[model samples]
Target: MTRIRISSGSRFEEEIGYSRAVIDGDHVWVSGTTGYDYAAMTIAEDVVAQARQTFENIAAALAQAGCSLDDVVRVLFIVPRREDWEPCWPVVKQYLGNARPASTLIHAGLQTDAMRIEIEVTARRPA
Candidate 1:
């Protein structure tokens, strides 16, 4: 199997030495994506907005891997505040409703208070 890497051009990728996503054969594995917009280098204060941006970031990485949300087979969501999860559900549904991937959510400390959410996904090209 051949391996390919996708970079989102985020400074962290260089500093931490990690790709945004990796494609190995037909499988795509995306890193934990935060709400910070790589181009804008900004994050929204509202949790819902952050959630939406998180998915957008993930989507971009998936596109680079020649996959889409529909290809996702598993998802993981991390939020510092449990209450914030409900507000982000609609945004999550808008992007992932069709995929209906197996998912898990956890409440935990994040790197910064500004970051409200982080998402990670694994996808496989349909056979």
Candidate 2:
């Protein structure tokens, strides 16, 4: 099987030496993505807004990998503040409710304070 790499043009990816997502055979692994709008390099202050943007970022990466959020089989969410998690539930359900991927949430520090949330996902391309 051939491997393919997809980039979101985020400086962090180049600086950190990682692709936004990688495709191996029919599987796609998206990197931990934040809410920063790659084109504008800005993040919203609210956790809910950040959650929405984070999913958009993940969707873009998935699109590049020839898949969609519906193809996601697993998801991981990281929030620096435990309190911020529940506030993002509606946004999470809006995006992944249909896919209903196996999911996990972790409370931990992120690379930046402005980044209230980070999300990562694993998906399989449709057969």
Candidate 3:
């Protein structure tokens, strides 16, 4: 099996010596994605908006690997505060819809205050 690396223009991958996502056969593992919209290079201050953007970013990485949110098998969320999780959950549910993956939420001290969310997801394409 060959390892395929994906980079979604995030500096973390190259600077930190990591790929945005890595594909090993049928599975794609996305790195922890933040709410920073790289197009604008700015983070959203709103928790809900950040959650939506985080999923969008993850979906972009998956799409590049020929996968979609419906293919996701697991999801992880890191938020600065627990209250933020409440607002984020609804927005995330909207994006994932009926394809509920095994999910986990953690309260964290993020690298930036503007970044209210960090998300990671795993997706698998049928063999």
Cα RMSD (Å) per model? Answer: 0.9, 0.6, 1.1
What are the lDDT figures for the candidates, one per model?
Answer: 0.91, 0.95, 0.87
Across 46-127, the per-residue lDDT of candidate 1 in tens digits comes to 9998888888999999988888999999999999998999998899899999999999999998889899889999999766
List where candidate 3 sits over 4 angstroms from the true fold: none
In model 1, which range of ten residues has the least summed lDDT?
Answer: 118-127
**lDDT computed for candidate 3:** 0.87
Better of 1 and 2 by lDDT: 2
Tell me the tens digit of each residue's lDDT in model 2 across 8-126. Answer: 99999999899999999999999999999999999999999999999999999999988899999999999999999999999999999989999999999999899999999999999
Residue pairs with backbone overlap in model 1: none
Candidate 2 TM-score over all chains jointly: 0.98
Against the true structure, whose lDDT is highest? 2
Give the winner by lDDT: 2 or 3: 2
Q: Which residue pairs of candidate 3 clash?
A: none
**lDDT-superior candidate, 1 or 3:** 1
For all candidates, what are the clash counts? 0, 0, 0
lDDT of 2: 0.95
TM-score of each: 0.96, 0.98, 0.94
